[model samples]
Target: MVTSPEEMQNEANKKFCVVVGNTVTGICTTSNAPADAKCTATDPGKVTVTSVPSDHLTILGTLSTTNIIMANWSKAMWQSVVNRAIRMLAWGPLGSHFFSAFATVN
Candidate 1:
């Protein structure tokens, strides 16, 4: 799990591969929040998983409600994006072998 903001900052310059078996058809990065992540498949599709930045939060009143609302919206948006990406890949030319690699990476 992601721990610090510095980790996310460092990940900004790197591409974390999304592996299915031995194939790497996508890359991803974690956000400032531990539970948040974003992935971009080679099929040119993207997916995001959102999370609340608890570091910036307090046990407040209306703010908590707002945060919950925002989190829900983000979750919905993430699901929609991920679904679109999956649908695109499922119908794309690379879908069948996207998870199968002919060679190994050292």
Candidate 2:
């Protein structure tokens, strides 16, 4: 999890590329990311998945929906989502970016 602003900035600088299935969809770089991408950082706590049927079903459903959305997305749509994720990571409060990223995709 990210702990500080500097570390967050470093992560942003890593220029990680988004991949969907076998295709490289979008890249996160200092150039393409928003100007305020490194404003703040917060650690998003981890989740432990117990061997529960409900949890398994939830995960499976989420994964299935994600696959469908990703498969239907155009290159530009993927880029827009990626860019929005970067912007949220940069400007939103702490771990809020994660939700923003997925929410935008939906």
Q: Could you say which candidate leads in TM-score? A: 2
Q: List candidate 2 segments past 4 Å from native.
A: 1-66, 95-106
lDDT: worst 10-residue window of model 2: 41-50
For 5-51, candidate 1 gives per-residue lDDT tens digits of 78656655344666667655444544332333445423223333334
Candidate 2 local lDDT, residue 95: 50
Q: Which residue pairs come into collision in candidate 2?
A: 37-90
- RMSD of every candidate to native, in Å, equals 19.3, 19.4
How well is each residue in 1-106 modelled by candidate 2, as lDDT tens digits?
A: 5479887666555444444565444553442244454322232221111232334222111222358767887768866866875677657775532333333233
Model 1, residue 16: distance off in Å is 25
> How big is the positional error of residue 68 in model 1, measured in Å on the Cα after superposition?
18
Lowest lDDT 10-residue stretch of candidate 1: 97-106
Q: What's the C-alpha lDDT at position 89 in model 1?
A: 58
